[model samples]
Target chain A: MPHDHHDHDHPHSLLPSDPALRVKALETLLVRKGLVDPAALDAIIDTYETRIGPQNGARVVARAWADASFRARLLGDATAVISEMGYYGRQGEHIVAVENTDSTHNIVVCTLCSCYPWPLLGIPPAWYKSDAYRARVVREPRQVLAEFGLVLPEGQTVRVWDSTAEIRYLVLPQRPAGTDDLTEEALAALVTRDSMIGTGLARAPE
Target chain B: MKEPVFLEPWHAQVFALTVHLSDTGVVSWPDWAATLGAVLAEHGLDRQLDGGEDYFLAWVAALERLLAARGLAGAADLDDLKSAWTEAYLHTPHGQPVRLAGG
Candidate 1:
């Protein structure tokens, strides 16, 4: 993560290859052509940034942890159950929930491209979309999880779910121990974005 | 692992633009997906994308193609705007947002 002084003065710095500038140009062109509405674009970005995100997934996980029947319904028909919670949308039309148990762990990956449940999780983090992650996680999940500081105990089976354009997987991390007395809202606070992605586990209650 | 506070802001801009286009019935979501998938396959061959600028660059390429195919905007218009922005960027002072003339 060190910044090299020389990198700041790199050659070809003047090239018009900056993605930010290119996007600005494209937006300007599209707006001028009346093909795109800037306000609508802003609203979409704002919605993703604020309204839709992992918090929704956290609530789902919390409900599953607290309600056995809901858990059964979620695992049986995720798309319908999730829609019942009012989280249905594009990129999230079909969702499959994978649960982690004492004997097994589950992780999700899109090896081909970044296809995620947008209504549940916001835009994926950089690591989830990285090529190294997409290629390596499927091949060596335990090692990748280890790099993310999640070292699982031996003997627990690891399940890697490869997402497709049709279906996206969401990991239901095991509820941390000592959380029985906690309220559902309090339990939701323990769920992290990485836990839902299966790279990390939910935080243990303090 | 440390998480950076942000990625390139423009990545989200282009992303929002695509979603807006689809949401407003400018293009169907399935068509956008197919177009983007093709672009990814073409440019993502044999190389590990960082999922940073390169991934979004492919998104832009696909968007341009989609717009052009739909007669929403011609390739020539994109090129001209790109050139204008590049000129604006080069002329603008450091730390200033580049803006096209009369825009």
Candidate 2:
């Protein structure tokens, strides 16, 4: 099939609303019917959220900005280093955190099923999951990043990391200057949610 | 012989809660799915399936466990939540999720 530029109907959302009642109904049938148990359900949830969240990621970014040795560890092996923080490899096994430099830029996305670094970063925001972000980023990362108010120098090629289950990603934003006296909490606050996602960067001190 | 339905009603409700929370900026993407999954497993719903519905069931079960663990609902609460969920989540009209029993 030739690639038609006119393809508008993305055949992804087959069900406009895949409601929760459907799961409840199934649980009533399966669990009540003895097909599944309470434990398996627990395993799935425990493995994901609190075990790995943005707070975890924020901790890492903060450490990187403050502690050079730990930053070296994180850059060397994101998954193992993050697990050292007691959260890693739960949702997506592999992990990577690309450092942003003044001369270069980087962005992240998941063309597939939103493969994100959950253990490091918290849940992804709604806009990140929007088709607008997914479809445009891979094709036009620099342009999209610009829309987020991030403009890389012309010589810089915006490196876009398409997140996969085998390898998740986080952005080690270049620590803003003039905040040498600022505490980690303040720096973490400067690290906007989108910055970790690689669409934006941390702002300078106010 | 019919195939096992991939998802259940409660599971659907769980997803709606998680998505709606994320939609309203209450949760993020990575944490949304994982947290939902973790909550469910903590509630002890993992040792059930043979891992057939890993992707779907994980979060669905998480939703159920969240509501129950948080004690966020009773039967009546669940009903009201279902109503709100149907409207806010599924985009269904209010008071018309189903017709009156015998209007």
Candidate 3:
């Protein structure tokens, strides 16, 4: 391999300082090596970015809202219940679903790192993996939630779940009020990734 | 055990690339695993440390080594691509997608 050296001719400031370039370079190298197919890579990216993201998790939340038995099953055994809907794989082998209620709110954080439920939620957002979030969420969750524009009622107690490799947690956001007549699909549309992560609430009907 | 956290967008991209490559029959899982292990061992690093920021850097290095060993590509090819990416990034406006120039 080429030795790692700083190019004195080009200013380091003008060079590719972002990790994106490094990733692109590596991808190009792999494709050129004939070890990776660009089409397959694009497909995978498309799948995670669009096909299998918060939409899957939203469907689960909507099901919980519409079906009491499904909600019970999901809370009691998330891994099995979620897998029943064809959403279980690496990083989501064991999932524990926690419900939000009138008196309680739920949030998740991995103090050491970011361990999100990729099978259901897809890749995590950049802010979720940030050091500021990991350090502050556990200490002052209410403040952090407020920063995300998720101010909760004073009576609601905040509960934080620290995720690890063995177990990952998902927040079952409370069903928004005045949505009793909405269909399951409509309800699913209201569930945002932030709501499932407990950083924000479900979108209020317009 | 340290938690596996992707610190940036590129980290996740690198991860997805590896998985997709393996799934598509480009590289066997065992071969990929062994190559990653050898790369980690070379730097006296462990899997636990691989959760940090430098984890993907190690991944790129391991991948380059594997390509070289397989005779698929060599050091010169990787260097050329790196230079191309550098040029692309420098010329492209900030917040815009960087593409290899003249490609």
Candidate 4:
């Protein structure tokens, strides 16, 4: 039989190889006051993954690009306006849509946890919750964005919004160059899911 | 022993879907899970049991523990988050679930 030794990538599963051995291990860890029960942390992850996702936010971005009046309305009444789509079910009472201009770009991160605009974008992508991405992006926005294939010129402030509260933000990137003939629906298709999350830009058809 | 890992289609789909979302730009969800999964592995821990879907359950268990300890959010927030999740990814034939008062 293969050895049941635990290691990185597949560690000691919650259940031990042997019931008796498992009890002994628990005695050393839980019984002997060793490791903490990671219940709260788990709940936090489920809360975001289950409640909010990036797709919700993407819908809003698509709508804004399609209508001028809606764009104006989005900036002025983001929460109220999005509610009309019936995406207003949960913690979406407060939605702040950040526009991306030629000089400015916006991305979001939750330093403590992966707090996201669940109502807008749905659950955030897995990488958003990583320590490396969250800790680094806010401080070294350009470097992190570059990792995501987003290269900005020197001196551009990569505005990183920490969506740690009710006010979740969705980045509305500037329309890409070329392909002006694309219809609104086509443009909506051009809006890459990443653009709404601010990691990438929306590209117009060539 | 844990229940089967990847038992249901939706369960497995959720995991893969999460990865796709991360690839797109919703970075945190997968990153955090990977980080946590790495830590558990390093510490000689199994993120889930042998049974299919245990891994997903483990993820849920870990996230719950994290949030409850923080105390910043509560059942309502979790519910809202869940509702948002269902709408964004679950794709139920019926309309979205009724939003709870707090949600």
* TM-score of predicted chain B, candidate 1: 0.83
- Expressed as tens digits, the lDDT of each residue in A9-95 for candidate 3 is 543334544456656777887776666787776667667656667888999999999999999999999999999999986567899
What's the lDDT for residue B58 in model 3?
Answer: 62
Model 1 CA deviation exceeding 4 Å by range: A1-17, B1-6, B41-46, B87-103
RMSD of each: 4.0, 14.6, 8.6, 14.5
Per-residue lDDT of A92 in model 4: 61
Q: Score the docking of each candidate (DockQ).
A: 0.45, 0.05, 0.21, 0.04
On DockQ, the leading prediction is: 1
User: B76, model 1: CA deviation in Å?
Assistant: 1.6
Q: In candidate 1, how many Å is residue A50 off? A: 2.1
**Where is model 1 chain A poorest over a 10-residue stretch in terms of lDDT?**
A7-16
Local distance difference test, candidate 2 = 0.60
Chain B TM, per prediction: 0.83, 0.37, 0.80, 0.39
True contacts kept of 3: 0.32
Residue pairs whose backbone atoms clash in candidate 1 = none
Would candidate 4 be rated incorrect, acceptable, medium or high by CAPRI criteria?
incorrect
Q: Write the per-residue lDDT of candidate 2 for residues A13-123, one digit (tens) a residue.
A: 122234444454433433443435545555445444335456667777888999899999889998888787777544446888899886667788876545677666655
Candidate 4, A78-150: lDDT as tens digits: 8888889767643365778888876778887766445565567664454665556766888888889899998
Q: Give the runs in model 2 whose Cα sits over 4 Å from its true position.
A: A1-18, A33-52, B1-103
Write down the worst ten-residue block by lDDT for model 1 chain B: B1-10
